[model samples]
Target: MSQRERGTRRVVRSVAAATATLAAAGGTLLACAFAAPGAGDGRPVAGPGPCVPGRCPAAYPDPHGGAVVGRDNGVNVFVGGDFAVRGAAAGAEGRVVVEGEFDLAKGSGSPPAYHVGAVGVGSRVPPDNGSPFLRVGGDLKLAAGQRLLAEDGPVNGTVAFAGRQTGTGTVSPKAVRDTGALAAFDGLREELTAASTCYAYDKGVPRKPTGTAVNQGKVTVFTGDGTSAFQVFNAPFDLVAPDGSAQSLSFRKIPANATVLVNVTDENGEARTINTSAVALAGVRRERLLWNIPDAKVVRIAGGGQLQGSVLVGRRSSTTRLSVAAVNGRVFTAGSLAHESGTGGAGGQTIHAYPFVGVLPECGTGPTPDGGHTDTGEPVPFPTGVLPPGFPGLEGLEGLEGLMGRPGAAGPDDAAPAEGRELPREGPPMRASMAVGATLMAVGAALALAVLFRTRSGPGSGPGRRT
Candidate 1:
């Protein structure tokens, strides 16, 4: 062939080869984008409330990074909140991790008892076919062998998913009048504290709320009125900057016999109360750096006691805190300790009471010193309209205790021997380790792609071969 003609043929061959390479790479990228399964659309998705109608099954990003939800097969829509699961429309199975403060709104006047907050479900209906599930508010955690639970007790604002909830660990209130889960939560605390290690579950077992979705039935929050209802800690307490008042002392100096009260009020004049008594104190009070929200201050008191509190306000206002009174400790209250900005979005304002010794108080059964209230050996909500600030509504490190106080050990049974009252159940067993199979598969697929595109010359080809 002529030199010019040979060069032209080579150029054409090169162009054809490059085109083939481009097409193969393009096709592979497209397949990965669609064929490979993703946890969910990396965007904010919502789910149907219990009373709402639609195909039902749906999945949304958990406000907390816990579980995922959706329908399976084509029937049964489920809502997974905290440790339990509830029914929804369609055929769907949802996994939820109820954490933080879930606010419960109630009827103002006429329909006095209607609940209007996120509630925990007991059993979850698995999805049929291979359809995806629906999640609301937060993410769903896959706890392998963990059994879901519907913690229906006095302290109503947490959903936990770890191990199965055995009858021995289920938290229960002593009387219908009590509004805290300290009674039923005793066993769970022993299990956790005994381990000396804890992870944050948006919905811990003790304070699981009632009702599913936002209609039909609702979780009730008692503002210390005619009958005290349940009040879950919607947010952590921000006690960094005190109002500079005598009431705001270091949590350590808080009289051992004194009870701490955290009053959470929303913009609508609606208030929820969370109180825990200093049955026992642990550790020494320490004033450490808590947090600093844009429009708020933060403080923390170090001690140990019956930690209890609630979260109120809007989505941005939910936080957490700890309230405790110890013998040698001084209570240091923070003012305007609510919202703060942090890395990804914002950090929650919270109060930490640490370094004191704990002693379980004789929270005998019957009425409180204030009367009409049960004496669970903790603090009793009073008639004072003046609520305490820096009490709750802030976010912080997981594995920490509640804003009102750290969970205490369960006391011995006080009720008389009744016939056949089954004991509370413990939580499901936790996985020995997280599932990394999906991640490994993705890595392997990427490696295969790399090898496929790699160019190599056969052994017979010396320097460069001409095809």
Candidate 2:
């Protein structure tokens, strides 16, 4: 062929090859734009099963964290360890057993009248001073020490001392019985522990609330009367009071029937601290509110506050301590009970009799209301602009589309592709597109360079002057 024709053909072939490469790249990009999946339809995805408002099971089998005290006939204060009523006029409607020494002395009498109903001293019981009067309805058992002074002080009941005693303290009829009156507390604590574990596990982990979150950790605070039947799952943080007072957490106007359960998991046990002193239940019964702090070492209730709920602490461990100004509900602790006297007197804290009923009605029976279920394993809906798996290659396409608006080649028909067909709703991935584009461009450039080199190196094409 003529050299001119040959050169023209070479140019045409180069143009054709470049055009084909461009076409291929365009097709690949078009496939990505029209074939990628679109963003979720913004509808709530079905999770597990139908979630009727009140269809789920209660978070706890026994609400009130397992009934520690009965409604009518129950003790005012039941200590697992040693008991002391110093300068505090405290009485138990039921029997009071002091695992260690029982000191019925007047410490700082704010009420000025130090008295007890039924006192069972496990260890030495010293002679009662003539000032503060100590009363006992049932028989008092003393391991050692002088007989109780019932002479001047009215002893409605008898006094049984294990050893000899001599003092002004009233000594009632001596009777020797079993020293294992407090043994039942062991089984009660165990039941509480098991119930707490089940509650925590069922609730799962706590997620940040969509509303305002305070402090650095994950916490959900409800102001005024909380929404009906609220449940906190796997909540491992501090629940401060609404007023933001000295760690005084308050729940005001909680509905009479509403129940609130805070299940703190073992993983976040160290951060569990609840102060319900300023809480106003608005006539809500104490049994309605429950706090499952299985691993908590200390639970403090500030002064001048009344908490309406049941507190379940460690069962076997002796590190649990419950410090409260005054409690209207039941407190089951495996360790010690410290009462911060607002009255400034010792042993003057009055523990009113309120038995725990059962789990709150709102906890539901199936799973937590946070869209998590123990029965069917299904997660909550995904957030907007994010895509789940099952779509091939379009991985990270959503981000790319967000970064670089929409693809220029996308048409009206490409808005929603055929159902069941995967499409890149967003643009092609930036990195992948750049890499592929660059590779194709480079190949096209190399092909044009080869054509130029071949034409120049051919006969009579190079540096002119052939003889």
| Global lDDT of each candidate | 0.20, 0.34
Which has the greatest lDDT? 2
Candidate 2 least-lDDT 10 residues: 43-52
lDDT of 2 by residue, 1-467 (tens): 65433543444354345435433454344454433222211111101001111112232122221222111222223333334443343433212333333434333323333233222221112122221122222234332322333222232332332232323343433333334333322222323333344344433323322123232222233332345554343446555444533344434434456545555433423335554435544555555555656445444444444455655554223333333444554455433444335244234354433344443321211101111101122121111111123222222322212211121111111023345865333454444555544554544444444445434454221111111
Q: State how far residue 218 of model 2 sits from its true place (Å).
A: 18
Tens digit per residue, CA lDDT, model 1, 388-408: 232221122111121112322
Cα-based lDDT at residue 159, candidate 2: 31
Error at 160, model 1, angstroms: 8.4
Query: What's the C-alpha lDDT at position 336 in model 2?
Result: 45
